[model samples]
Target chain A: MDIPRHWRLRKQRYGLVGEVCESCNAKVFPPRDICPECGKEAKTLYTFSGHGEVYSYTTVFDAPAGFDETAPYTVAMIKLDEGPLVTAQLTDLENRKVEIGMPVEMVTRKLRNATDERGLLVYGYKFRPVMN
Target chain B: MTEKIELLKPQRPVGIVGYGAYVPRYRLPAKEISRIWTEGQGGLPVTEKSVPGPDEDVATMSIEAARNALKRAGIHAHQLRAVWVGSESHPYAVKPTSTIVAEAIGAVPNTQAADWEFACKAGTEAMVAAMGMVGSKMADYTLAIGMDTAQGRPGDPLEYTAAAGGAAFIIGPAENSVAEIEASYSFVTDTPDFFRRAYQKYPEHGHRFTGEPAYFKHITAAGETMLKATGTTPEDYAYAVFHQPNAKFPQNVASALGFTREQIKTGLLVPMIGNTYSGAAIIGLTAILDVAKPGDKILMVSYGSGAGSDAMVLKVTELIDERRDKAITTIAYVERRTEIDYAEYVRMRGKLTMK
Candidate 1:
């Protein structure tokens, strides 16, 4: 990752900052220049409430490059309170405890370290169970 | 005439609008460390210590604590005029944890954010700065946080006590607060009982030297000074929370200062959670606030390794009764725990050298 890419993704990574569709009033994440639902320009920025529920999940036991350190982790499709589903890793929970419909909230965290020496550290948002 | 060390009382009383603490659900038993090292021979200082997952750090934990603070405060994030984070383990060596926390909580653009470091007392340092800002009307509300995913070297004594957790406090006007800050005092010295040099990951300590001259001396001086300045004794306070590096330190200090174990037990979480470093005292204070009734007076003193102590007195208000239910209490977080074995603890902390 280059500096510009890191800079551009900061808002999304930091707060799950996204955009709302003006025409259909749809909430979209991984923010796009155009709304996926209405196929129209989305200039208005939308900040997510960070409240969501697990829609689906899988535990990865197999190791992948750079992710080998954290193998056997749980990744999930979270259905935001708004009308969007986000895919991210689940944290602050045991793999066995994760289930569909479990409430969660977004938290900013280290996504991954730099692959090479002298590389920038990458940070982003992940979800954890919303503790009462 | 000599300049006196006046108790720090805001010109306009500022109170805690909201407060929250977060201890990661993952726990590493002290016995597990002993089992691996001393073969379970020596008694452990703490029962267990909290561990941050691969994704959690000071920033993430601070965000959670800040969110809870916002919830109880019942104020829009935009209404915050300042956010200050104090931590020794700030994830990024170059980046500001406060800005990320401010932006994550939606307080960006309208707030002044900065990071602070004063060893373990960093949290209280932020609180003092926030009190000054809010009390002087420079800011309507300020958020002060102390959090850490503290680190320890493998097999080091520090490993047994260095732990993960944090707490956040919202400071605003007395009218909207759950508890009012009556007065505060700080006592610091050039003692070097503990330190982690630049580029070093683990900290070294003076062992027995850290006791009498560092933790004990500073805490007692601050506590006594605050008591004298406020014209009160230990018996006057309903609860007392001292910086807990381990179970014994706070208990010993409290007893010497004429406070009963009963008065200190409510805020003593270091036995179960280890020392949260910057989060230690504030987390203890938050735990006390969880059960304190209106009109209860609390005395808190925090110690740092460098070393110094920040002492303060707080009085619970009627507002505390109504707002206690606004967010989850500290006990709620403490009660939710899942113990992990030694292997998993090492893995979670990334202690194993990668091949």
Candidate 2:
């Protein structure tokens, strides 16, 4: 939530900009410097295509601290088209209607508020169902 | 030569190369808002309005609409020379919404970006500037957008009508355009029909004053001026789109200007989605463009409550049919909606206070 932390993670927060393993052709999100698949250093930065499908999901009935305003939200694990499974909250859909394999696309959104403390707004990526 | 209207004709013929609109899927019925207050006596003036999710704002909506515009333009985002966003509800107070949009659309590093404000007509204001930039050969393509996740103070009349949505247009030469701009004109006056001072969360308006002397006066003046300047009559236009603050104003204004119900009905969305503030007129224009055939002409007038109106004459081209299907149309967005009750609407819009 501090300035440095926010600045350092911008690439990952925006566009899901990460790294793809050159040696093993594996995709890593929130990108890792060292590829887990081949134990080699990631040399190339890959921006995600942002098209994906819901792989798994659960409705959070119990609100977490600082998230009481948006309780009972559905969070999902999305399998990106480029081969990375990302955990994100499902947006613009009914909690009861969230199903596995629903098509979605990434969008920038306000993640949380630091209103009580530093008055900082944490913005990042969230996924919404792709409109026809 | 004597001129009656100061028509804005870019140095060269500029037209809409591409266009797109985005209305969030979530809808909040006016009755739901009225339900929360419980003290209001009458039925809701508008049926329902679109609401932005907790994560969404003008910046996010503009990015989505701009992406759609780029898709229809069939050009790389890098090829865009300018990105302009006009909105009253820009997310950050100090930061420029255009920069965020420009970076999101990949038009950064060399493109011009700015945020504009003229109330509801802000989007059209940006469009006229974009046309000038492209027509002057200063840029090959310019992206202009009007978007807002507008806010309405609780228990206020504006709350039932202020809504969320956006539309984007790519301006370029007429040679590759889908809708050619024949001519445009602007009218302004020292009318204080609606306004929001600095740091005010919601806007204020002069109840009856916003009607005849503000919305009607500006819209009629600009509408008549554009028509006369273009040497066209109301009968010559296939459709006319007026800035819709609510369902009643556009209908009344259009009728007073000699346009029939059928002529304005196609672009009348305020009854369904409330007023998107800056996005109101441009989104309506996008709807008309979706159904209009090649060679159809449209009269569009946008009113902002400072107040002023920007009027334009546009002629559709054969290229419209080819590009219309390339992206999702306005009707699709309007139809793909889900209704939410007052509680959910409040939560989604982040109206609740958190500790």
True-structure RMSD, every candidate: 2.1, 2.5
TM-score of every prediction relative to native: 0.94, 0.92
User: Which candidate's TM-score is highest?
Assistant: 1
Q: What is the C-alpha lDDT of each candidate?
A: 0.87, 0.85
lDDT of 2 by residue, B229-274 (tens): 7878899989999999888889989888899999998888888998
lDDT of 1 by residue, B1-355 (tens): 9667699899899999999898888888899998888999887889999888776779878988998899888998899999999999987778799988887788989789999998898999999888899899998899999998888888888788889997999999988999999888989899999898988878888989989999999999999999988889988999999999988989999999999999999999998888999999999999999899999999999988898999989999998877777777887877778899989888778776765
lDDT per residue (tens digit) for residues A1-132 in model 1: 378988778888888889999998988887987999989988688999888999999988885766666667788999999978999988777745887999998877777632233466566888889876
Measured by DockQ, the strongest candidate is: 1
Error of 2 at B208 (Å): 0.3
Candidate 1 positional error at B3, Å: 7.0
Sliding window of 10 residues with minimal summed lDDT for model 2 chain B: B346-355
| Model 2 C-alpha lDDT per residue in residues A1-132, reported as the tens digit of each score | 387897677667755878989889888887988887889998687878888999999988887876655666778899999888999877777644877998998877767632333365556778888867
